[model samples]
Every structure is written in C-alpha cells, then in structure tokens.
Target: MARFFSRDRHGRRPLPSDGFDRALGIAHRWFLDRVGEVATIQYVTAPADMDWWRKDNTPPLISGGIGSSGQVALTLHRKFIELKYSDDGMLPERLYELLITEWAALTGKDVSEIDPEF
Candidate 1:
C-alpha cells in the first residue's frame, strides 16, 4: 500500500480523493469500530501550523476529545489511526435550531414548544 500525506501536514487529514462523503464514511467506520453506534464526534480545537518539525517531536492531533467518564471521541489525525477523548456538550446554535425545527416538523409539535435535549 502507498502512503498518503495529508494536505495539511500538521493538521487534519487530507480530503480523500472521493471527497467529504468518503471521508465521513472513513470516520464513521472508525467510530463504529471503537464505541458502537450513537457515539458523537467533535472537532475539539483547531490545529496549529508550521512547527511540525519542531523540538517536541509530536505529531499534531487532528482533533482530541472524551474518556472513561462516559464520553468518547473518534479522531482522524495528521497520521491516520490516532485516537483521543472528548466531552458531550450543548449543540451549536445553528445545529440546535435546525434540530429543533426538524424535531417540530417530524413529531407534530409546535416549534416554540419543542425543547431539544442534546
């Protein structure tokens, strides 16, 4: 097998030639392999640049997040197959709004009365 270098050497994985869906498939499969279905994925923090060749000798993480505290994470890193931990938290405002709207539509509830959890 040939090696593939990520476009951002010190950051996230390079987009696979097949595109975002394929990349999502890869992440989903990896997530399934570890914790099972219904686990959430998070982009913990942004990656830093340039200093990859620095003295620390650590490969930059793609995203790091959860642990034995009932939380889990799946990460795709600068190098493939590096795993880390993260926490579950409030959804972003846009996502929350979208989910709320979708939830209202799906369940036949008024949008104002739908209080989404997670």
Candidate 2:
C-alpha cells in the first residue's frame, strides 16, 4: 500500500527570499523523519490524477496536486513536491522548488504545512 498527502487553498502572494529552497529542505527532511522508515519514495509526477488507473500496480511514490499545465497545486506527504507547469520533460527538482515557493507564499506558511495528524 502507498500513502498520499495533499493540501488545498486559494490565493496569491509575493515571493519570499530563498523561501522555496528552505521550505523544501525542511519539508523533505520532515517527511523522511516521519515515514521514511516505513515507506520509500519512488516517483514524483505532475498531472498525477492521470495515473490513478495504474496506481494499484505502482510502487509507493508521492503524488501531489498538479494541474494539466503541470502547475503544482499541492504536495504529497512532503515526499514529492509539485509545480505549476504542464510537461513530462520537466525535472522533478524544478517542480519541487516551484511548488515550495508558491505554496508557502500562497498560504503564508511552508509547503509542508499540514493539518492535524489523524
């Protein structure tokens, strides 16, 4: 079985200095600390919903909310970061960075900002 994490919000804001990189670093490490011992991160993809038909057969990977344009609307479990773009050719790093930056600025908190652990 695999795990999925997601957050949803709406708004716009200005960018912060080094916010993306720092937020991503914190989120990545935080996720590892929480679920690393139990599950391993495999793939990170945009338009993740497209793969839902095959999710049952796939390995444990992180799936965030990616628009058809590849714009990341959310991150999943901090394992994989999403971006705001639409293309299979983009690198995960670029997506991750953009995701952290936008998400933080949008919500006024880090991308890793999660709800209660229940």
Candidate 3:
C-alpha cells in the first residue's frame, strides 16, 4: 500500500517520500517500453504558488507543456494525485493514457501504437 504524508508545519502538502518517485519511474519505463526512444517523458509537480491563470482553464492536475527540445513535458500535480489516492479512486491507467495521448500528438506517433487498448 502507498503511504501519504500529512501537511507539514508550513501547511503545505509534501509528496510521499517514494510514491511519486516510484510512479514516475514506472511511467518512464512504460513510455520507453511502449514508444521507444523518440521522446523523453517527465513528471513535474505544480509549485505551491504557481499561478493557474497563466495555465488557462485546464485543470492543473493533468496538463502538459512543451520543452525546449520540442519534447512533450507532462506535469502531474501532486496535490490532485494525493486527493485522488486518498479517496481510493486514483486510476493510474487513465493518467497513463493521458500521457501517452499527449506524447503521440507531440511525436506524431499513432496513439494506437503506444496503447493498443486505447
């Protein structure tokens, strides 16, 4: 079972010491295995003070940004992940699909090639 940490003295939630790291590793390996070396997959947590206004109306939890190298940079918000996990409703498969879909778009790869079940 995954363990989550409570808010610290600063009243900010910190990611589980290993949960996000493990999830990111799994996601990286999944991308490498499914899509090969065409692009790099990275996970970033939203800063506590990040301005959502600049991000448009999209929920901060599942959004992607482009990198200097034209690679797809997926940012997964930790707060949202924790909320979903705590509710026992987190679906990693859904997140994977989102990432894979964005990757396909960015790399011009067929989404079916990355996830046949999509």
Candidate 4:
C-alpha cells in the first residue's frame, strides 16, 4: 500500500514558514523520515475526504473538498504533473521546490530535480 502525508490549514501561507506548528513539525518529520525508509510517500496538499465524485464533472486527479475548488492528488504512477486550476488563486509556483526540499529531509534522498513542470 502507498502512504500519504497531508497537512490542512485554513488559507494560504508561505511555504516552509508555518508559524507555531514548527514545534511539533520536528517530531512529525522525524516520524516521516523513518516511515519513508520503508514505504512510499505521497505528500498531499490538503486533507482528503475521499470525495472525488462531484457534480459528475470532476477529473480523476482532482478531489472534492467542502467549499473548495478542489485539491490536487499526485500518484507515483504518473510521469508528470498536470495542473488544472479552477480559480486564479493558483497554487504557489514554488510548490515543486518545496517538495524537493521536504523530500530530502524526510527521506534522506538526494532528489536533485523532478519533472520540471511538476
């Protein structure tokens, strides 16, 4: 089975600079580090409720959230990232950078780069 990691907060906040939660973050990352060694890590952008069906118009890669445009879900089987935004409040362009940074700290893997579009 695959392992997913997710963090949910209200609105937009700067990446890696989450205030206050940094205290527990240390322990959380440590746990992920160990888990990463034995399992695959699928970092999620938001908490998932397994509600992909919405209005019968949603795509497979997008998940439905309560009053949300939608949340992106990445699967390891994909070779690239396909971003489809419903709103202009797009996901930070630096998301891949954040992923690369976190991947190393949590997995001890030297992920120099990912699919550029990711």
Please tell me which predicted candidate would have the highest TM-score against the true structure: 3
Per-residue lDDT of candidate 4, residues 38-117 (tens digit) = 22324344335435534575534321112233232222211112244222122223333333445444435455432233
Q: What local lDDT score does residue 14 receive in model 4, on the 0 to 100 scale? A: 28
Model 1 residue 113 distance off true place after TM-score fit, in angstroms: 44
Model 2: runs farther than 4 Å from truth?
1-17, 37-118
lDDT of model number 2: 0.40
Task: Tell me the lDDT of candidate 3.
Answer: 0.63
Winner on TM-score between 2 and 4 is 2
Q: What TM-score, to 2 decimals, does candidate 1 have?
A: 0.30
TM-score of every candidate relative to the true structure = 0.30, 0.23, 0.58, 0.21
**Could you tell me which residue pairs clash in candidate 1?**
65-85, 65-86, 66-85, 66-86
Comparing 1 and 3 on TM-score, the stronger one: 3
How big is the RMSD of model 2?
17.3
Ranking by lDDT: 3, 2, 1, 4
**How many clashing pairs per prediction, in order?**
4, 9, 0, 0
Candidate 3 per-residue lDDT, tens place, 1-118, comes to 6476645757676745555565656666776778766454545565666676457754455566677877666666766665555533244554565668777776787999777977
- At residue 37, candidate 2 shows an lDDT of 26
What is candidate 2's lDDT per residue for 12-115, written digit by digit as tens? Answer: 44334343344445545654443332222223443446565456754322434445654444433323332332332333455344434544454465554532
> Could you arrange the candidates by TM-score from highest to lowest?
3, 1, 2, 4
What C-alpha lDDT do the candidate models reach, one value each? 0.40, 0.40, 0.63, 0.34
Tens-place lDDT per residue, model 1, 28-97, is 5543443243434433233445465356765444333345664544343422222222211211233334
Looking at model 4, residue 25 earns an lDDT score of 41
